[model samples]
Target: MVQQRLFGLIFALVCGLLAFGSVNAGTDGVTAKQAQEAEFELGKRLFTKTAVPACALCHTLRDAGSEGAVGPVLDEIKPDADRVSKALRNGLGNMPAFKTLGEAEIKALARYVSQASGGAGPSGN
Candidate 1:
């Protein structure tokens, strides 16, 4: 149990770090497998649907089956829940604010982007 918690913590921390560039990253530990899957599901919904200005219209994540290159490749960004949340909340460089999205959905998007990256836990600056 302790080991699981520790691994979760590490995963959360890594996700946060990668997602936000360590800029006031918050609320990690959202790494349960089920949660991750749910996040992926939500992300897919957001990506394909136009209701919330689908991500596919701008960015690309091959795993999500999108090839858009308008914005940075989401899969390459390596964002996690917190980092993803911050971006949605703040509207980074060119990605407009998705402030209407609730925290859960935003976190789900983060998880979706990070996991889809097909990469290990967050690393680097």
Candidate 2:
């Protein structure tokens, strides 16, 4: 009877482990590089389409294929992530504040711009 209980406990433990593994299976295969790429892609999408008026409408970014004449050329300026975040949140010069975007969205956009323009530090907002 004790052996049967032990076997049952082990079986339960194994089943629980299997269930947990399956639950995390989708994320277990993703590499750090893949996650970073996904983040960059998300930022690109926000820049081109999700943001109000769209960053592509006023910013010139070769990576995004935008040829806007209003904003400064990102390739030349290469503003860092913090600068981009500040400008996005509070507005800078002719740019309007993007109050609609959340902190995560701002961070992603900042990272994307900083990286794409060869700016230093893709750090947080």
Candidate 3:
């Protein structure tokens, strides 16, 4: 009787283990917060990287510590994310369309600029 009970227990444990192992579940990949941080970092790099013209070269942003006089002061303009994104996508006035940047890069840059300029909500509203 004791041997039978021990065998039953072992079988149950093995079955439970197999069931747990066979169950497929999606993994918790990088969180939204992590993705946002990564995007912000990439945006910052794109803004100031040497290979590109660098937004910092023409705009003044406290975060970037850029004091460029050619473009409107980002600190004063404090444009929303949507506004910034549109400008980057289509350009305006003296600014040329940043067609080279990918959509994702442009979005990231807009979010970064808006957030740094005190527009943190969605669409920087």
Which candidate leads the pack in TM-score? Answer: 2
Instruction: Give the alpha carbon lDDT tens digit for every residue of 22-113 in model 3.
Output: 42333434444555676676667667662147899999999988888899998888888888888888889988888776665676688788
- For all the candidates, what are their Cα RMSDs to the real structure? 10.8, 14.5, 18.0
Q: Which wins on lDDT, candidate 1 or candidate 2?
A: 2
Mark the regions of model 3 whose C-alpha exceeds 4 Å error after superposition. 1-29, 120-125
Model 1: per-residue Cα lDDT over 1-125, one tens digit each: 34423444544555555566553324443434444564467666666563267888888888778887788887777666567667788998988998666554565566567677754433441
- List the candidate numbers ranked by lDDT, top first: 2, 3, 1
What lDDT score goes with residue 36 in model 1? 52
For each candidate, the alpha-carbon lDDT, in order, equals 0.62, 0.75, 0.69
* Pairs in clash, predicted candidate 3: none
Q: Give per-residue lDDT, candidate 3, residue 94.
A: 88
The candidates, ranked best first by TM-score, are 2, 3, 1
Instruction: Kindly list the per-residue Cα lDDT of model 2 for residues 1-125, writing each as its tens digit.
Output: 34423433543444345446542435555444544565576578778877886899999999999999999999999999999999999999999999877665676688889899899765542
Give candidate 3's TM-score.
0.71
User: Could you tell me the lDDT of residue 71 within candidate 1?
Assistant: 82
Per-candidate TM equals: 0.61, 0.74, 0.71
